[model samples]
Each structure stands twice: as structure tokens, then as C-alpha cells.
Target: MKLPILSQEIVITLQQLEGIGNKTILSKIGSIVCSSISTLDDLLSFWGNLKGKKFEAISNDDIKEANRIAKRIISRAVDENVGIITYYDEEYPEILRQCTDEKGKIDVPLILYYRGNLKALQIPGIAVIGTREPTPNGVKAGEYFSGEFAKQGFNIVSGLAVGCDTTGHVGALKVNGVTTAFLANGLDWESIYPKENLELAKRIVANNGLLLSEYPIGQSCGRYGLVARDRLQAGLSKATLVVQTGVTGGTMHAVNATIASKKPLFAVEYRNDVDISHEKVQGNIMLIREKGAIPLRSNGIDSAVAIIRGTDYKQVTVTQPSLFD
Candidate 1:
């Protein structure tokens, strides 16, 4: 019997299967945690044994295919300058490991491929996301809320997409506050979506912030990529704030994911002139009126900060900014 931590190659192999959405990867890695798994080859054989006995081994081709996928993922990460951190790795963020569901199930990710300052993971943070194509009111709300949140010393997290997501990052940066962008594409911090935000991404990293992803390099920003990306946005913080979103779209997806994960949500209130009755604002309102997501206030951010720090508003002390500030 050996320790999983001793077999670096096994940990790497498990990370390769991260986005495969397989129960086998979970069980195989969980098996390696304690008892006696020894060498890298032994860990491989353990997975192989599970496939053979617990699961019928379809063919040698399966193992070959798995290895091939692993190589491809790694190659892309190398090309993009992405750093892959397995759950077993010391660099994996500690806050995420503490998530507990209603049933006490932890929603820990297998690996987190990140780019930019790794130190940002240790800092307290909040997320802001909403409609992809926001209206004027939504845009202002996102920016205003983000700027104020950053002022209060909360590191911002967003999907790095357009509309509410990008606005949040921009607002935080405007105030000389730290902000992190989570991407759905490859780990290469060099590229960014909308190509318009490429410079914005650089500014974020330059400001001592981070750009992170779970996927490999050159991975297309597709449906699954966004879904995987959304989880990081929601789970990386104490609360999620939606400036605007339609009843049936990206904002809705993010809001629902946050709810499932049991994180708090705050939707910006509708403006008086904009048709609050429109479908775009429906989701935000629903979260407030039905699902119990709190409403935004001029002071809502202060409340959010208190919640995140687990301190009363008066008890919350301020900290000095680093070089990024």
C-alpha cells in the first residue's frame, strides 16, 4: 500500500480525465487517497483493474484513447502557458475544498487549470454576472455595483464574457481594485474573447490579478466550456450578483447554478425608465421575489462584504492594497 500523493503521474492522469464527466475518475482518485496505492504504475493498474472487474474493460483501445486525450490536453496547456492544478496538488485553492451541500456532499472539482497570479485564490472574492447582451440600465448597474464592491476590498470574479461579466471587471479595475477573470477558452492568458477584451485581460494580470480556466489550451469556447466556466464563477465566491439577465438565457444559467451550489445571489433592481416589465429583467426579479435572492441597494455591497468576511458591518476592518492597488 502506498499514498496517492507519492504518485505524481497518477495525479496527472486523473487530471486528464477531469472534464470526462465520469464516475470512474472520481472513484479511482478517491481510491488512491488513503489505504495503500504505491507506484505510478500501481495506480494505473488500479484504474485498469476497476475497469476490468468493477466495470467491464471494453478494449485496450479505451486505455489508448484515454492516454491520447491526456496528451492532447497537456500539450494544449503547455502551448498556452496554463498551469494545471489537481485536487491533490498543494496549489489547489483551499476555500473550494470546504464547500458543503445540504446533504454534506462537497462539489470539489478534480482539477483547476489556472493562469495569472495564483495568490488571488487565497484572497476573499465575490462574483458578478448577468445578461450577455445587456441593456443600458443593466450595463450601468453592473459597473456601479462592481466598482463599489471593489472599493470595499472584495476581489471581483467574472466569466470574462461581454455585457455584465466584462463590465464588472472593468468597474473593479477603474477603482484600482483587484479583479480576476475566469475563461471558457484555453489557459493561454494571451488570448481573450470578443478580441476586444484582450487588452482588458492584460490589464487585469498587470494589476496583480489572475485569469483562470479549467480547460486546456486552444479549447473552443463552446457550450460545455461555458457550463464548466460558470461553476467556477459561482463557486469561487461568497455571493453572486446579477446586474441584468433574461428569463431564459446565460444569466439564468448562472443564477440557477449559484442556487444549486447554495451561494447567495443579489439582483440589481430595475430602473424606473427601463421597462421593468420586460422579459430581460424577469429572471432577476424572479430570484428576488420567489427564490429569495436579495435585492441590490446603494449599500447592498457593504452588506455583501460583511457576509463574506463573516463579520458585522461595524466589525469589518479594512486592509491596505498591494502593488496592484
Candidate 2:
């Protein structure tokens, strides 16, 4: 499953270039690197054609720094047993290749660093996302729906954040189901965000799940990175479920990305008896009322399962007696 050694080196070098991480810039570079060039021997001709072009303006110093960084990245990846999948690699996920933004711009990452089963990406899955802080009801909903989906053979996809996301992964693992965690930082343990999820991440890998990232080794998580990571979570799934969320947060970003990508979105609906004024469930209401997201009955795993299976089911508002009820 290894790429040609030379191709791997060249791809890593391109990733190390400053400003190449930008999707538009990376797309342009990818066209050249994946098309006219296949190895380091072709880099000269590729560089010569765009010496003064705006997108191809890499200085000599930039090349030197890129070489150094690429070497370090390669060394670290090996030391950590992290797997690298470039855009041109055959192992790259096909679903990711079709992802785009609201404006129809391609939003796929140029490379991915992963640990554990790459095969898990090929399985049917749904992204489960929600607020970092969730009400007890929201946590139960996440666990119930995700665990139900896992039992039905759907891999759970989510960002490794706290609250609902953590519960989602735990639910899947409870049933010995596969799950994939899309990280906002590098795959290295030193950069795993929240620090608390380090054990959770390990459990995922141990349970045949995947820990994936677009950043290279040593990169730290940042606001923009987390925002960007949301797209991959949506892109990787057949559908996205918002267990609970406030109007503003990473969960909303994932919802927007799912809509932009034209994936099916299901938002949990709290029963009328429950307090709807809670900020945690505001985003779910907004999504259902404003964004046309299908309303998922509270604690109704069958409704979610039917949708994924493409069977006819009532989309009418459903309800759960309580969070765990």
C-alpha cells in the first residue's frame, strides 16, 4: 500500500512549502504535481513553467525551508507510525475528493496523516456532531443515535471534541463498531487537542477506528484549523446528525459544510415538555426551522436508521420521554 518512494518524497516536499496549505493554492499546486510531474526529476520542468506566476511564486529560500521541514515531517511520521495519503495516492478517500464549499469550490485537503485502519474510510458512515458542552439529554441522544447506527453497521464519523462527540465515539465503541476521529491538529500525540481525549484517541485506534488529520507532524491546533476540520467530518459521512448545539460553534460550521456539500442533515428535536430555552439546543431548532434540516424525533433511533437505509419513514416530529428514556 506504499506509494513510490520518490513520489512520496516529492509530495511531502510540496506539502512543506509555505502557503501551500491553502486549498486554492494547493489545488493549483496539485494540478502541476499530479499531472506533469511524477517524481523529483520532473520538479525542474514543473518549476520552470511557473517561475513568476502568482500561485507558483516560491522563492529559493522557501525551497530550502521546505526541504528541511519535509525531512523532519517524514522522520516524525515514521517514528510515530503515522500513515500519509496524498491527494494523488490511490488510498485517498473517494468521498473526500467530491467535497466542495458553499461556493462550489473544492475543499478537500491535499494530504492526510492517519493512524489505524484505512479500510474504515471505505465503509458507510455518518457524522455525529454537536456542541462541546451538551445538556445531559443531548449527551444521551448522541450516545443513543450513534450507538444505534453503529449496530446497524454504520461507522461513526466525528471530530474528537468533548460532550456529544466524545459520547458518540464512546457509543460506537461500546458496540465494538468502527469510528473515525477527524482532528484539528497533527496526528502526533503531542498535538492532540483537548488533551483529555488522548486516551479516547488511543481507544479508537485500538478498536480498528481511525485518527485522521490534514496537518503534518508538530502542527498545533488553532481556531482556523478546527473550523477547517469540520468540512472533512461532513465530507467523510453519508449524512450528518446534529445531536445538539448552540447557534454558534464548531457544530454549526459542520452543519453549514454538510448543507454546502448537499449531504442529508438530521437535527434532533427536543420534546415540547423539555426546556427549549436552553442555549445548547438552539442550533438544532435553528437548523430544523431555518435551514430545512430534517427533524429527528427525540431518542428515535429507528427514524435515523430508516433515513440512512433509504426506506420510507414519517419525517414528522418525533419525541423522547427524557434524555435516556
- Report RMSD (Å) for each prediction in the order shown: 5.9, 3.3
| Tens-digit per-residue lDDT, 1-325, candidate 1 | 2224523334445544434342455565564455444344555565565534433433445545556667677777777666777665677777666543323355566667777788888877788998778877777777888898888888899988888888999989889888989888765644456577888888888887888876567766777777666767777777888887776676665566677776677777764545377677888788878977766755456666665566543443324221110
Give Cα distance to truth, residue 70, candidate 2, Å.
Answer: 1.2
lDDT (C-alpha) at residue 124 in model 1: 74
Q: Could you say which candidate leads in lDDT?
A: 2
**Cα RMSD for predicted model 1:** 5.9
After superposing candidate 1 on the true structure, give the runs of residues whose Cα lies further than 4 Å from its correct spot. Answer: 1-9, 15-22, 33-42, 45-72, 98-106, 189-191, 311-325
- TM-scores of the candidates are 0.80, 0.88
Clashes of each: 2, 1
Weakest ten-residue segment in model 2 by summed lDDT: 1-10
Candidate 1 lDDT trough over 10 residues, lowest sum: 316-325
Against the correct fold, how does model 1 do in TM-score? 0.80
